[model samples]
Target: MSWLVTGGAGYIGSHVVRAFIEQGITPIVVDDLSSGHREFVPDGVDFVEGQVQDTSLLERTMREHDVEGVMHIAGYKYAGVSVARPLHTYSQNVQGTAAVLEAMQRVGVSRIVFSSSAAVYGTPDVDLVTEDQPTAPESPYGQSKLIGEWLLADQARALELTDGATPLQHVSLRYFNVVGSGTDEVYDTSPHNLFPLVIEALIEGRTPRINGTDYPTPDGTCVRDYVHVADLATSHVAAATAMAEGRELRPVYNLGSGDGLSVREIMDAMQRGTGHTFEPVIGERRPGDPARIVANGDAAARDLDWRMRHSIDDMVTSAWQARTAHPDISE
Candidate 1:
């Protein structure tokens, strides 16, 4: 049986697809290609170009591919942009997730691995965030993600209450600051993302700017958890495997590093990785920016085999290697 990977052609989704392929599992892709590239879907993989909101299309794709599970990664991911486009964000994330779940129920596919975000914690007051942390999303994107988790939980419960119904086993992986490229063929194309923005500026011979430098962190800039995309992909695969093997799993897990790196530390790694020596220009801190928001991934470490396998240097080096190899990313 194959798994349907929504947004399988996107950066993190593409890595998840590769991980599934490497493990000899068949992956069928359904992506609209709004921000994702078609070429990112590897050769020989079944690809269907469509939005997640189209329930008819999703049901057809699952039925045709004999999909037994889903890895839901398709959504509008721009936090800053979502502030201006709240309706569009809900349309894509909230409504779109509801559509995916509806299609899953229609096709009787019960297993899912949701791609969540730490944005749900919004400017967390504590230094270390845990799964039990109060969710108080500040942005439309974050609210949408939290709502998506609720939809999944409610659906699972609904299924459990149905007579002769198979309980929907699912897990949501919340994370922050995903960077680095698992392969040169696919890189983060987000216009608002930090790593890509820095790499692009450096490649174009322009100095990258830091948003703020007055935070309470060691270097003044904000500190946040950063995890390698490959490691995140591995945990996704592990979650899927555990579900398929009938192993008990948590409803939610944080794919995070207990310790985090400040923006200054990231800039230092980028300089060493890209051979750029220019200092970053500091700009006014964006509104609602948190000083520090790291998470304890001990739960995932024990269950999903999650670990910080790559350092800041390794993340920068691999990301730079891919960025340089794919010069068109700067375009």
Candidate 2:
């Protein structure tokens, strides 16, 4: 059976799609090409260039592709932007998710792997945030994601109570700070994350900007767990397989490297990775960003058997390789 990947042409979405293809699954993609690049879409998969909020487009794509499962990853994903423009974030993350669910109900798609975020946890008091952590999102972006997951879980439970052939089964994978270059066919150039931005500053003979230096951390910098994109892709595949093999399970798992690293540590490691030295200038902290954000991956490991292998050095080195080789992101 085929799968549907909303925002399948985006950086993270493209990697997940390629991961599915590697497993011999040709997923049909729905994207508006807003932040997603058309070139990132692999050759075999059907790429429907349209908005996820468009019900007609979603229904048509699902029906035409005979989609069995949906890997939903379409949404605006910038904390600061969401803080600046809450309405836009709500429209894309919340409304877009609702639109996809409506289309699935219309076309009879049974399962979905909703892409949630660690932002939902905001500034948890604990060092590592667990799946059961109380959601207190600081930004509108995080709030939108948390609300979307709630929407999916409630819908699933409501459907399960009814007598139906295939109840809507959904799995929400909340992740943070994804890093790594995708396959040769898929690469991230203009990444908003630190990995690509650091690489960009290195190649340009400029120091990477450190958002804060006064936070209560080892180096007074914000700390975060960076999981490899490939590992995340594998986790998505596992989520799909779990829902398929197991009778019924609607759960949420946090996908992240349990080990936390501070921004200063990351910059230092990156300098070592690329054999380059550049100062990391400390600046005013970006609003809504907490001092530290790390995921508690125990739930995902127990439930999905997911594990992250790539180290920070690997992430830095690989991203540098990609950026240096293809500075223009041409093919």
lDDT of 2 at 37: 86
Q: How accurate is candidate 1 locally (lDDT)?
A: 0.91
lDDT of 1 at 185: 85
For residues 1-331, what per-residue lDDT tens digits would candidate 2 score against the true structure?
7899998998889988888888777788999999998888887678999988898899998998888989999999988767889999999999999998888888888899999999999898998888888999999999999999988987777778867635888999998888877564555654567787787777777888888899988889989988888888888988887887864554788987888999899889988999988888888988778788888888788777688878788877766666676656432
TM-score of each: 0.97, 0.95
- Model 1's TM-score against the true structure: 0.97
Top candidate, metric lDDT: 1
Q: In model 1, which range of ten residues has the least summed lDDT?
A: 284-293
Instruction: Report the number of the highest-TM-score candidate.
Output: 1
